[model samples]
Target chain A: MKSILTEQQLEITIKRLAHQVLENHVDLTNTVLIGLQPRGVFLSDQLVDEIKKETSTEKIQYGKLDITFYRDDIRKELHIANRTDIPFSIEGKNVVLIDDVLYTGRTIRAALDALLDFGRPEKVELCVLIDRRFSRQLPIHPDYTGKSIDAIVSQKVKVFWKNRDGKDEVCLVND
Target chain B: MSLSTRHLLGIKDLTVDDISLILETAEQFKEVLQRPVKKVPSLRDVTIVNLFYENSTRTRFSFELAEKRLSADTINFAVSGSSAAKGETLLDTVRNILSMKVDMVVMRHSASGAPHFLAQHIPAAIINAGDGVNEHPTQGLLDAFSMRKKLGKLEGLKVAIIGDIMHSRVAMSNIYLLNKMGAKVTVCGPPTLIPKYIRESFGVEVNYNLKETLEWCDVANVLRIQLERQNQVLFSSLREYNIAYGVKRKLLDNLNKEIVVMHPGPINRGVELDSDVADSKQSIILQQVENGVAVRMAVLYLLSGRNPGNN
Candidate 1:
């Protein structure tokens, strides 16, 4: 196992990602943040907290989306669904789709399909804590990334959250 | 997680975990139903067939809507106009349909254990819509879903299954499910309508008094009088039965506390459930119909997830 980002580094990277999101959106009046369900929620939750702390505002439009129903590979295996609580409308607003890791890009593909069902957004952006470069199966690229790493297909990149995993770190594990 | 059994022949065959998983999955589908699109691509690649050897309205349409909402291709078969009327056997009918590459079968038959019989011979996963007076597993599931959604829990909840228990597949399924989920159940109706060994066999309370039953339960699942299924005169007449056992507004109003009212529908208003009580705020009859679609969707989706080769 190779450690990519330690606990302190993960905190700094999250703060940097929050600032980058705020810099792009300015006041975030027409923007919304959506965390992908199951694993991606940890990153998005912390990112939203950091954004709130920086802006000194608790009115950030945020929600969670579960894309299990929109996956193209559903026939291959069964996936249990999670709660989807996108309470606010995303119509004509800039939406940021957040997740923990980006690889193969199939999840992002399914997420995009799931998002269009809510309402047509003005634009959709991708934000991730770790981006596994050179391994995407689709043309999806992240607008804000905490770290970019190059790994082979067999290697797995996992992001550990303090709230769930008892630590905040990113690691590359070889089988 | 996946269901323990591939075929939903009856609620008697399900574990509490299976019931909970299905209801939990149904909760997700219920949210999907509230969305703008109200459809999903989870079962787009699968095809299902609804074989109704018996007549139906809610179960048939609920299963059809559930299949369509999941983007599944469905074929509806009614015994009246089908080859069955031309003296075809059940096995031959299903075999012919299987040749069309169908993945699942939702069947309602007048013969008990019909779906179980089909499951033994067919490669397709079978969901028993209602088999004789045996079990309507989906209706049982939706009832539990509606109860939990309203009362917020199932364990230790007092539920009374009122009216025609001897001929009610819904009651059988509900009793099996409620017992497995740790809920308290009582079969309430006329003495001749409820089965004799029900109290001993299913470990449920049996009541002959309608008003007493209503006051002692948290939810009352009143069933329609299956007059067609009854060969002998179980009661003097419809009016006599209504006066003795019908869930009238006057009786419900006399209860010390409000209790949820549910019916498996096609309600014989004034005979089993009065129209005023059926339309009352405490009645989740319409929400039961709405949840029926989601519950059936969960069943179909989960059963379809099993290995296709095995199914």
Candidate 2:
């Protein structure tokens, strides 16, 4: 029902996440970034840009990944497919799986299955802009977290990117 | 919409949303097909039997590829002039096969409603590959999926299905599915090949003249003449049928509008379509073949409650 993150806060959180990624993994050769499909694509693109600017690294290796078919809730209803454009090989590379809002951790779990079809990675990690508190159905946790939201079960966490929705902000909606 | 149908007996049994869901799922699976390692470990424990009563090289091969891609252990049950012709009933044969603990049956029988009949008696999933003159649901699904991919949408698109309607499970299924998708489907062919009371029953228009049908439609689905199924009652000769219904490049170009040409293949190239037209830019015949693999995968995947081991 209210805006938890304004434009300035979203921009600041993105810069902080970029610094954290660089501080953790300095040598970015084998490190590959994959954005979960749909909204995560926008956030991942911004984060990739921030990392590149902060570290002076060209071609940080990022792509979109869709896990629609691998989802456990596939039979519950239909999910529209998003474009996946991972041109580089992820085999033996450090894979960074990124998403906007991490609610149940199920989407990331499905992404893990989808990533294996490409090839086996040396290591796989998760990154999310909004970590919805106390809402994970799986034991999966993000390696890099941007802004954690203390939201209840009935409310939803939504992230809007300036490139996409003409503003950068996060809001909690009553379902 | 979620898929809940126990059997894919026909397009007549599928709702429009069901058709949409299948196409959407096929879209994702199509991407999977393009991957280097195309096989997935989704249907690992599931045993699917490709029980083909009739011989169709493309359909059988496509279904086999789909089954393998999903990691389902598939057994090809091809009945020749042996047991099926030696007076063994279809029900008995299917039951005997099911006794082997098969999880699903993809059957292509010569008799209409054979799969439907099997679905009634069997506990396994029944996928009607093609049941004589009744339906080839997967073929129909892929055709619509291809059309929507090429044309951007299906609703209100004028689709003319030319040649051999009465004998084609493809034509019947296409009519049922396309009409449900809000596409205006006109059955065009020699009057003898078209079943009577289709207009009265299915409420679809019938066109006898090929040129008129070509000019009035956005896409023309040219069906191969089922020469094996025809007799003296239908038409005089193949040459006469070719002259009347065969789609040539000249006829398509003269329409002055881009009309997509589609054929459920094993194409009698010079009979239903000219060899040039079959390989023409406007023809999506190859796309139909490629899409058939994905559509069948979507069907098998959804039928088993999303078979690829859900994470």
Candidate 3:
């Protein structure tokens, strides 16, 4: 039932994950991070900013992806998310796929399919802001996880960013 | 960070947020045009292929300016000069462009679903400039963007699109997009010119009487009366059609002054609309042309995700 991660804790976790990412991925030059649209995009930017501040390296290329079309949820309708604005070519770049939370993993699968259409990335590592230990449909896990919360399928965790919301926090909502 | 794509093909494919992003981006681009430099580094290395099978000047030029201002490399490919007239298939020409390592392709073809067709196969982002009288998605976006700028809010706004309903792809795309964004849409044209089951398909009202439709909305989008489709559709004569549907001085007098007048050009000055009305203060025909570039820029930036020259 406790899916919420405090603001201070989330910050510390992201910092730690950023450090770990820098440590494992030595060459920051070829590394680029792509955030899944909405929340992941903002999180990817944050991670890039934090990492840049820590390492004092050139800014990592950030890409946003809208995986709505790749989603298996809604039936094929005329109106669906079709335009994915990824300006930079992903070819040969070491990509760090960032998302707000790792839930059923269907989104990650969709993201992967969407990414491939752009071009073949040299390597792609999953980075989740929060990894909720639940029923995952696919074999996907975060290479870099900000925090982990164990919760039932019915429970939900919402990520609040500082830009939109004055504070950054994850709350447990009863769905 | 940098955008990854360069073109937008259709509105059906664009999300509500994406639509908003393009609108917002267009607003930003519009500000730059007012300045002296009137250029940006967003598309320096990006090559935008304007592969138009159909003949268009305003739309084509709008896209060209949008790309050049963004610092993108713009290639104007027409059927006359391009290999397509030399018996090349649509897919082959697109493949050739792809092979050339071009970043994006903005296509205006006579085939209704050409953009959709290219969107499926091409690696470069496909932008629907206008496709086979099926969907002029960019025009719809520009029109909606213009309306939103003028009206401030789109929700619950009554908008009636009149003239050449069946042949006007502008009307078709606008109906879908405008209705989706919370505007009530009514399509009006001569009964013969209006396609069968248009109302039932899109959950919108259909009216043949232009006077009634004009009275029902805050904005009346007048489509061009095609000279070619006149006799074929058997709409009697231009003079008769003008008397009924034209936004003439008399009709304009009857409507509210605040009720905006619009047309997707090149207009048939006195056929679907009077010259005075077309050139009036309320007409957004020129603004629509200007907004076309910004909308196209936004589309190009969003689709390819590549920054042209600068961020």
Candidate 4:
């Protein structure tokens, strides 16, 4: 296992990502942040917290999306679904999708399909903590990224959160 | 996580974990129904057939809608117009359908253990819609879902299944499920309508007085009088039964506290449940019907994901 980002680095990277998101959608009037379910929620939750702390605004239109039903590979395996709480409307707003890691791009593909079901958004942007380079199976790229790493197909990228994993770090593990 | 069993033949065959998994999954599907596009592609690659050897309204439509919502191709077969009317056997009918590459079978029949019989012979997963007076597993599941949604939890909750218990597959399923989930259940109705060994066999309280049962429970699930299923005279008449055991508004008004009312529909209003009580705010009868689709969706989705070798 190789540590890509330590505790201190992960914290700083999250703060930077929050600031980047704020800089793009100032005051976040019509902008919404959606976190993908199961694993990506940790990163999105942290990012939403940081954004709230910086802006002192608690009215951020944040939501959680579960794309288990929209996956193209559902026939191969069955995935248990998680709660999807989008209390606000995302009809014509700019949406930022947050996740922990970006690889293969299939989850993002499914996420996009799931998002369109809510309503058509003005624009949709992707944000991730780590971008695994040279391993995407689909044509998807992150608009805001914390760290970019190059890893082989066999290596697994795992992001650990303090809330869920008892630590904040990113590691690339080899089987 | 997948269910422990390959087929949903009865609530008697499910563990607490399996029931929890199904109810939890149904909660998610209920949210999907509120969205603009109330459909998912989870079972797009699969095909299912609904074989109803008995007459049905809500169960048939609920299963069909659940299948369509999951994007599964479905074929509806009623015994009235089907080849089964031409003196075809049950196994022969299923075998012919299986040859068409169907993945799952949703079946209802007047014969007890019909789905169980089909499951033994076919490679496809079987979901017993309702098998004679045996078990309607999906109805049992949706009832649990509605109760949990309303009452918050099932543990230690007092539920009374009132009406014709002897002929209700819903009653059997509910009793098994409620018992497994740590809920207290009582079968309340005319003494003749309820079985003799119910208390000893299922460990549920048996009540002959309707008003006493209503006052002692948190939820009252009144069942319709299955007149067609009764072979002998269980009661004097419909009027006599209503006066003795019908859930009337006057009786509900006399209760010290409010209790939820539920009915598996095609309600013989004024017989088992009065129209006013059935249409009251406490009645989750319609919500039970609405939740039917989601609960069925959860069942189909979970069973379809079973390992091929597992079945």
Question: Model 4: residues >4 Å from true position, as ranges?
Answer: A56-59, B309-311
Each prediction's number of clashing residue pairs: 1, 1, 35, 0
Q: Put down candidate 4 lDDT per residue, A12-97, tens digits, no spaces.
A: 99999999999999878889999999888899999999999977576688999999899987777888999998888889999999
Candidate that scores best on DockQ: 1
Evaluated against the true structure, the overall lDDT of model 1 is 0.94
What tens-digit string does per-residue lDDT give for candidate 4 at B1-311?
A: 68999999999999999999999999999999988889988888888999999989999999999999999999989998888889999999999998898899999999999899888999899999999999999999999999999999999999999999999999999999999999999999888888999999999999898888988999999999999999999999999999999999999999999999999989997898899999999899999999999999999999994565532
Model 1: which docking level applies? Answer: medium
Query: Which rank order by DockQ, best down to worst?
Result: 1, 4, 2, 3
Chain A TM-scores, per candidate, are 0.98, 0.95, 0.88, 0.98
Write model 2 residue lDDT over A1-175, tens digit each, in one string.
6898899988998898888887878988889999999888888899999998866566588888888667776445556566677888889999999899999989988899889989899999888898987899999998899888788898988788776788778999999
lDDT per residue (tens digit) for residues A1-175 in model 3: 3437677887887888788888877777788778887678778777887888876565567767766534554222211233345667788988899899899998899888767766788999999988887668889888988777787887888888888988788887888
Clashing residue pairs found in predicted model 4: none
Q: Which ten residues in a row have the lowest lDDT in candidate 2 chain A?
A: A73-82
Error of 1 at A95 (Å): 0.8
DockQ values per model: 0.68, 0.31, 0.02, 0.66
Give lDDT for model 3. Answer: 0.78
Error of 4 at B134 (Å): 0.6
Q: Between 1 and 2, whose lDDT is larger?
A: 1
